[model samples]
Target: MSANKKKNLNSMEEDPTADDSDSSSEDDDDDEPHPDAYTGNEEVEIDFEGRAPTDPDCHGISQLLQRVFLRAPINTMQMADMIIAQNYVGSVICQCEPDGAESDMDDDMVEEGTIFGITTVINMTAKKDIACIEQLRGYIIQRAEKNAPDSVLTHLRDVLGNEGRPVGFLINERFINIPAQISVPLLENLHKEVLTAKQKGMQFNFSYFIMIVKFYRKEARKGKPAEDTYTNAEEEVICSKAVNSFEYSVADECDVGMSGDWLEGDATLTPYRKIILLDAKDLPHLIDDIRNYISGV
Candidate 1:
């Protein structure tokens, strides 16, 4: 993996929730200078590096995981530890600081760096013995049985219950405002890493992949029907490539604490979780579709 790759931010979107009042300008005489005259935007460059999650990254990794499993009784810290311990198949995204910025600090004393995103796969069949993994497996099954269609339920049981068919839970998580473009490189690298692990005789060989995707349905208004929006839009592209997928509302199951600004308004939105199953052989195609969708190709 490249240790210090740089990406231009010109194509990235600004935070939608950011306060625009600071940039607002008052009208001025044609000849006089306006205090907040609009200036041309400059292209910003950011350096992002991918590295194996380590002991020091648990806190940062867990924080990101918490957002995904909100109100669910999963132990995110243990899950983070498992990701770090696996070490061979996943990556955590971190910003690359300038050289020598922390030269004075001892190596051990270096701060737990910020984590921008994480992508990894957990072998559900192999890791069933783990407490957190078991908890998650049971949670998914319970939710599906309660909310998903019979077809989805039967498919999940056939795959998860059969020891010969290993299922991988793919986790793609990040902060709310991160652009979909960052996901392209992260997912591509994850595919390469998993293949390399399989070649090393690791237990990464799998029959199917299960992904829990986050999305919200915007309430209908003015005679228009409700609309659903994917929080990470690129995942929608992956869903298009899936063999089977189903969505269920989590609004009743989630705690009040899970509600955010998006849920508050006259035309309120409802949050839903979509479960998608894809053949392992089709992962490459899904990744390619995500790349194309994000690039507007």
Candidate 2:
């Protein structure tokens, strides 16, 4: 209500539990940033874009929301919408009316947990039915800004099928299923077809699951990593090896009714089809998988 309070409420706070819900907008005085999001930070006013700036200090805002989205009892569609609305397509963003009372702010943030918003950001445009899940993922890895040292991100265009269990991209020319009932041609089309309007553009970037195999260093087998020795692991090698052992690309696994055996039977003609334009960088890993599968390796 008062200009002084409004200014304080709009600024991000230090606790990391500040609320941002406009549910109380009907109550004139209830509109303001959660103390956690506005405290101990710059005293700048809200930007034209409601979201926080993409600054080093404010990087945790998005990460906080991402944690809430992922852990809350919500669906992917809801998560997508919330993220898009909050980010406003490159627009700055801010929290809505605080989610709880001043006294309860700490509890709310504790429930939501601490946020690390400076994840890699992505921009993509799909066409027809392009396979992008892989590309989305590659971009996350390629653009990572955090020192996660343990995770990678991936993104892709919308490519839904009759089911939505294992999300994938149109990376391979075919699909591969464990039991092998999905269709190769249809999956190919799914990979190629852009369900969302490529006219404007559609893309989602999320962290990829990490798969690591540990080998005790010849010296580490004797003790904890030497205090002065910098710990290191070859990510590229790990990425390459983990992929090499896979039997199919996201394309092949996601294709309608593709099966490892079915693809093999059609080897006389190479059923593979490049229905979608793929990120050249992620191709080698994909190619190696298909080649190995074909060789029954």
Candidate 3:
């Protein structure tokens, strides 16, 4: 992890900043939120009235809400207004619905590496409590460490999984590797725990992930030709609801989301949005475009 890049995935910091590369763990002790930040108690708290969303397979909450809002026969401004009134921030809510329903499918991605996706953003609230933000951060850290025989992870996944609340994670690609047998017991443990959290009116998070995959090359046939190529022979257990449809076992390389942080923001004058259902890497450049548009440059 470059000490300089202090955003999600690479960010171990509670706050994201331009000069965060030099920051040490001790630096987060301050009570200050960032200059462009707005923090608040963010939740969707859907009663569901014994009904899931029209499309429940979609794993991202922000994505789910956006779709529901858009499909409700309301204008953009009206839908935006509803989102703000609900105190909604970015979150990935995992839900498994009965078959044949409108799908709320956010993208499902898997990769092999120590690096993965996680993000940090500033909240915009006048009455926002910084302590709440700090407390939230502490809670997340504690969540990750609750599991014992903790994998290569220095932190436990529980502290990070906090009810599917979109949290952030810091991944040092250099921090992950496997020499002995790779038994994904931790991921299996996480899948079960996520269901329990939802039963009690909570959401499971999908922000930070630590992905490590091992691969081997073999021979195979494609239609008429036979070829021996690389394949993944290991079975990776994942939280089914955390993501959409996925294969139970693959042999080439195994990638699973690791631990991380969720972002909460405020929108009083303008509408606030986080967890846009779009991948962070995709949106960053667009955000740059928006900034340029805002400046009339």
Index of the highest-lDDT prediction: 1
- Give all TM-scores, in the order shown: 0.80, 0.21, 0.18
* Whole-model alpha-carbon lDDT for candidate 1: 0.71
Better of 1 and 2 by lDDT: 1
Model 2 over residues 127-223: C-alpha lDDT tens digits?
A: 1132333333443333232322222212222222212322222211111111111112222222222222223355533112222121111222356
Model 3's number of clashes is 40
Candidate 1 error regions (>4 Å): 1-13, 16-46, 100-112, 252-267
Clashes of each: 0, 42, 40
Over the stretch 1-297, how does candidate 1's per-residue lDDT look in tens digits? Answer: 344333322122344534434432222222112112221242223355667777888887786676566778998899999999987778887656657665332233223376666789999899989999888888788888888789988988888898798899899976444578878777877898899999999989989998888888887899999897787879888888778778877667544333221232223778888888889888888888887887789
lDDT of each: 0.71, 0.26, 0.23
Ranking by lDDT: 1, 2, 3
Better of 1 and 3 by TM-score: 1
* Tens digit of per-residue lDDT, candidate 3, span 178-247: 1011112222223333445547655333343322222222223365442221111111121211221111
Worst 10 residues of 3 by lDDT: 171-180
Among all windows of 10 consecutive residues in model 2, the one with the lowest summed lDDT is 172-181
Q: Residue 122 lDDT in model 3? A: 20
